[model samples]
Target: MAATPAWPPRSAPRLFVAGPLVQDAQVTIEGGQAHYLSKVMRVAPGDAVILCDDETGEWAGEVNSAGKRDVVLTLRERLRAREAVPDFWLCAALLKKPNFDLVLEKATELGVAMIQPLITRRCVADKLNAERAATIVTEAAEQCARTALPQVAAPVKLETLLRDWPESRALFFADETGGETAAAQFAAHSGPAALLVGPEGGFDEEERALIRAHPMARAITLGPRILRGETASIGATALWMAVSGDW
Candidate 1:
């Protein structure tokens, strides 16, 4: 006889629910998730629904009931364990709203462990909508099939960021003017690391000097071209993942 196919097909809708997902446990999904199941996907009883608890990895579940306001499913088995993401963080300077949204989305897809929004003198925006940002990252993770969600931190001033920097992590500073090659520097480092990129107007002279003077800061350059704020963050992150991360 042929081997049985997977219980939940890859086409099944995936969601990240709160709390732990145990075997044969009932999971009640509400709000927009319910709408997505009942009204959108029209999931029926026994239909597979992939779920991640953000704590216990991914699980395969079957719909027990679908109501207008809620959908309940019984988890059958754990599909996979929580992924091991690279020990990389993106300490990016605040950019325009749309640009920053792209940053959050791509950063999540790129598997950043944490995102620290920086407030600099040249930053166009100093504040971040925490709820909205969280939603963007969650959606991005769902789309990318990432079981582990990156932590989104509140916006912090550059001075405070530098002051509270971890002693062991290497801070790769993407300086527009010039520095060591990014790919080379990333390949050389082996421990916890972070990338710091500037805003639209780039870092001010004082800010640049301060970052460069930090003991953990290793100035790096993307390439010959000077990338835009969003481009720099996204591109540099991709490059880092390919070089030093779990690509």
Candidate 2:
């Protein structure tokens, strides 16, 4: 006889449900999720879908029923434990909405533990729709097969962020004017760390001085060329992960 399809097939579609998955538990997929499974994926009973609760890690689930508006699933066995993401945060200065959204999405995929949005002098935007921002980050995590979702904190002013900076966490500020090299600094540091990126026009002189004066802030340069807000944010994060994170 042929092998039993390897429990949940590797090709099975994956989803993150609000779950505390237990063996033999049932989950009813509703709203857009249901629509996607039924209408888009066209999953039928007995087909498999990988499910992650963000708390219980990955699980094997079999479709029980594919209704018009909902899809029911039965959890079988645990496939893997929740991912161990590094304690890395991306505290980036806010850019325009679209650019910010791109940073949020990419940060999730790049395995940031959290996103702390900062309001700087040259920032184009001041506020974030919390729910919408969470949705974007969640979708990015799910699409990229990240078991843990990155927390997208609301935007805070640059001064407030600096004032409340955690002493235990190293704040690697991506200063356009430059200080220490990015790779060297990342290699030298360990434990809870965050990368601070500037906005479109870059931080004003006063803001830079304030950040520089902060005890936890370590000024780091990307390169000779000045990069845009989103580019700097993502590029700095990728470099950090390569050196200090679980790359």
Candidate 3:
């Protein structure tokens, strides 16, 4: 008897597709994705490629044809269902371009449900390139094999965020000045929660007062050493996941 190879080999390249995936359905891969598969991976007919539709789940796929401009795939079988992300959100103050990009990438990898970019008085940047930010997070999710993508919202003013925040969700404010320990606060609240991180120079006195006065806000500190805006966002998100999320 001859041994058969695994259905989808471990070396298969995973990707997130747009449309819903159904068994025996054909999916067209174009643009950069086509280049990666045809030119980079050099996947020929019958090669396996894993596909994930954010709505459905993960699916095993087989490359049907390959061309310079497009690669067609046939959906084989359902591998896994869409991942259920935690109810946590990262409300991060906008930092420099590179720094904010880092925040978006790591937040997606950490599996936060949503990313809310905040515009604070000390923020270096008041706007975010939504398309660029989406691409960054999408790539990060694809690399991490995430079946679900985090919702990224446009940058909003700090006061507006505080004002519109849901009362049911606990907001853990990462105040540079001081407050309760992050890990402890996160462990104490296992319900729907969020973390608010300040910008480069940290939040101003008035902004700090506003956040502190908000009923849903609970001031928390990362540690003795001060961290940059991106660091705080990433670190606090990871911590919350470990403590209260599906870690």
lDDT of 1: 0.94
lDDT of 2 by residue, 1-247 (tens): 8756676776788888998898889999999999988998899999999898889898889999999989999998898899999899999988888999999999999999999999888888889999889889878987898999998888999999988888999999999998899999999998999999989999999999999999999999999999998999899889988897478
Error of 2 at 185 (Å): 0.6
Off by over 4 Å in 3: 1-3
Per-residue error (Å), model 2, residue 242: 1.0
Q: Flag the better candidate by TM-score, 1 or 2.
A: 1
How many steric overlaps are in each model, in order?
Answer: 0, 0, 0
RMSD of 2: 1.2
Give the Å shift of residue 177 in candidate 1: 0.4
lDDT of 2: 0.90
In order of appearance, the predictions have TM-scores of 0.97, 0.97, 0.97
Best by lDDT: 1
Error of 3 at 39 (Å): 0.7
